[model samples]
Target: MRRPTSGCSTGSRRPWNGLGLLLVLLLAGCGGDGGRQTPPPEVGVPPSLREDAGPPVQVVRLDERQAAELSVRTARVRAALAPYTLSLPGEVLPAPDHYAVVSAPISGRVARIYAHEGEAVRPGQVLLELESLEFANLAADYLQARADATYLEERVARLRTLVEKQISPRSTLDKAEADLARARAGVGAAFARLKALGLSDATIEGWSSTDRERPLLPVTAPIGGVIDQHRVDLGRSVTAYDEMLTLIDPARVLVRGFVPPEEAAFVQVGDTVEVGPRSASAHPLTGRIATINPALDEANRAVVVNALMPTREGWPRPGQTVNLRIRTGTPRPVIAVPLAAVTYDGEQPVVFVRTAPATFEKRPITLERIGPEEAVVTAGLADGEEVAVSQVFSLKALSRFEQYAEE
Candidate 1:
């Protein structure tokens, strides 16, 4: 048997049985199992290494697939020359020294009204006539005082002559002189009273000795202006406190502008202003700033600015409303964007700036001024950067979503 012929197999070896071959394969598979054993725990790393990475960054990185689902759009920001001016609503007012109210100076019956409503009058022109029993009594007292004054003067002269001629005693002459002086003082007091009743010195001095006429007290205009109103009619009884007339000189018209406090700093006493009537067809009136009130209006919270405007044939009346355009300075270059591009993030003003393709970042900006359709950016943005114009809120939403996911 030679021990199965040492290195060679005999034909009767049965070609290595199938069970034995299968056992060999199984052994080979088991030999490599130790090599596949899980990497011995990454040497020096902690088990919670990934957990210690902290929260995800605030950046939103969207691939093309993410942006395709939204209707977001953007615009390139560029430098612009924005106007530096303010438009405000204003009203026409009577100038400070040109408005007047006429009131009854004394209790009287209206005898005649010479100045009618809407009539123009000059200073010292007769406005109306009043007849009063108080005035008649005053006139009578004045005339009587004058007569007594003259008679006492004659009596004083006669007494002096009598004393000088030794016909009357010195005591009697002194009494006569005292009575004459008293009479003269009374006459002076009566004249002063007449003057207080609005009588001119010329009228008082021109009175005739035989004139016993009941006086008609004339009310005269205090200034040259149009008669805006007349309250009294013929025979209408009025008291001293009644307002009988109103006068306003259109030549002294002022445009009173109520500007918001934000723009008040630009207004001064010499700024130019253009004012237009409420009607679109009327021409605009131009003027210069006459005053800028230091205090704000308590009712509207606005700074009051006044412009001295020409009368312009009195087309713009007092208390008439108007529109004002105040030119502050010349236009200059600035960085601005469309007003629609800006939105608020809480109380902070926010804008979305495009950083890369289909990528945006929410940015806070400082606005210098806001025009009708544009906003001037003072900081936090530069020219040539693209900004989201439409559907910017969508970008904000994505940022919010990423925030919630991290939480």
Candidate 2:
């Protein structure tokens, strides 16, 4: 074999070096990742993040036969005159004219309490009894006065008889008559005192010396109502001016609300308003505006409105929070549908808009206001679109059932 020359050896090493360099480059490219890759063009974020949402596709498809079986009815949405309503927070309050404050007529100890807080009472019903020595003294004094008057009348009669028979002096007869008049005046004063103490004429007349019962002053209710509060307890001492109890007639209540200054001009006395409890589902209490305060509240710049609301028995208690719905603005043309056509889907008010025969799509609606039987749609509905009205509950049930099935 011929020895390799220096130039050939160096040239051979150079080819090896080139091959090694190529291998190193390939190894780096394929290190952990299989091959080199250009970072992909940033595909933009998710569609939901962009907030471009399409119309809801909640469809309830049914054949004509199925629709007939469900008895689902539809009505065309039409423009109708609708009143503008404003709902304001309000409070149920006792009508001032229908409330009574029971105060102690005389200073005494509370012997008994016949009615308690929240108990119904009738007019003239005894609510409390007071053991008053002062009342007994007055009764005793009246009796004494009456006895003295009777005695003097008899004496005067005798004196008159004597004078007519010429057995007594005329001056003596006159003195007897004067004494009788004075005694009679004393009796009258006593009777007036008893009357001032709230004693009936019959009661004053019925008192006799032989009576065994003490002169107990019975505090009676002046009006029929529920006892709203009791300030005195049994055996508690009370004064003449002390408030004993407060009574309120729940049937006669006022729905009191304050309207914004902008709305104050629209409120008028005798306007019908609907009052309902804030949290209760019962039917609204119907009433008429009884008064609108001429002055505005200094703090809130609102005008006070009072509505005379007739409530059910023992309902709409005083101080209860409520909502007062007042229709103020003139009627305007609006897209309206039957209230039955609307239903709630997880707090969203929606109506089924008919797309095709026996095919309905649930669409959300923005309501301007809702009345007892109709709803005015401000948006999300068209003028002539047909909406499911009758049997809407059945349709809603079916829709919910289908949604669960799909899930």
Candidate 3:
């Protein structure tokens, strides 16, 4: 009985004790029910690792009331021709033929000023009068020469008649003819001198030997313009060729743009250019390049480009600094939007594209060029898409906030 059959014996098995029964129960529990496998311990997984996770949300939603409060306005992206532009500093100048410097034709004292600075004058209008002794001498000489010519002409006529009538010697007639020629030459020389002193041919033709009035030289305007500078006062003594007044026609102007030497190749004669004041609010004037200096400026090494301005009233006065935008390359078709519709995200330009009435997708864009009114988008945008032109900053803020909230 002590060596009795064990629980594991192949013969008749003995009934198990309490300890053996407990061990069997423990082993059965470890093996699971009916030899079925017991699963491993459960583990927690991140939401990102889940098979059902969706892509990141890139859209920003707004209610009608919110959008209205922000004054959000949208514009459709448009296909347009965008030309490359080069910006340069420029100066407003008087057109070459429309400007003049009035100077003294003879040494004289300024007797009168008919046109003051800033006064507009017409062509051939007397701008000033000069009192000079030299003019008096010239007038006297001219009168004397005319008198001698008349006297010699009468003598020649009388002598020719006498010689033809055989009442005077041929030698005497010849001598009289030579004297008349000399007198005519003297007259011509004196007339030239009077004309050189700024006297018109009409005035010279009208002068007589009997007239004793003091000769006054009238300085006339060669062009129609406003007197921009007056350097002489009444009774001021000036010499020949001395500058007395400066005149400029503001209606006809030129914008001279100074371009960098490297950029000169893109500019050519007849290219359209826009000129305006330095203030952004000023309306720009359009013109075509009239000339491009082949040589660079020695001082600044900049190429000089000139554009003739169309006649306009009261703008772009001479000596005024201006802004010049030269359209360089040929324009190409591109998708464009208002400048206000674009915003920056950490230096990355982005635009909010309206996918629905209340939803916008923030999309990055590749800008080919940005102009004063619009930006040319080379990539990441399509024509006919609507973008928020107003309140873009608000949309950017909302996008950032939503992004953080999602994180």
* Candidate 2 stretches greater than 4 Å from native: 1-83, 279-282, 298-300, 329-407
- On residues 63-179, what C-alpha lDDT tens digit does candidate 3 reach at each position? 888867886788987776655688889888889888999889999999988889989999999988999998888888888988999999999899989989999999998998898
Model 1, residue 265: distance off in Å is 3.2
Model 2 lowest lDDT segment of ten:
47-56
lDDT of 1 by residue, 68-103 (tens): 876578888877665556778898888878888888
User: Which of the two candidates, 2 or 3, achieves a greater TM-score against the reference?
Assistant: 3
Off by over 4 Å in 1: 1-83, 151-188, 279-283, 329-363, 371-407
What is the lDDT for 290 in model 3?
Answer: 93
Q: Rate the local accuracy (lDDT) of all candidates.
A: 0.81, 0.83, 0.85
Better of 1 and 3 by lDDT: 3
Candidate 2 structure quality by residue, lDDT tens digits, 1-407? 98769988898799889999999998887894776667889988765466686654688888778887876788998776655567788888788878999998888899988899999999989998999888888888889988988898899899989999999999998988888898889888989987876777998888886788866898888899889889899999988779999998777887788888765755678777888877755678787788898898777678989888777866688878888888664346789788889998888799999998888888989986666667778899988999988777777777888888877
- Report the backbone clash tally of model 2: 0
Taking all chains together, each candidate's TM-score versus the true structure is 0.62, 0.57, 0.62
Candidate 3 local lDDT, residue 318 = 83
Indicate whether candidate 2 or candidate 3 has the larger lDDT.
Answer: 3
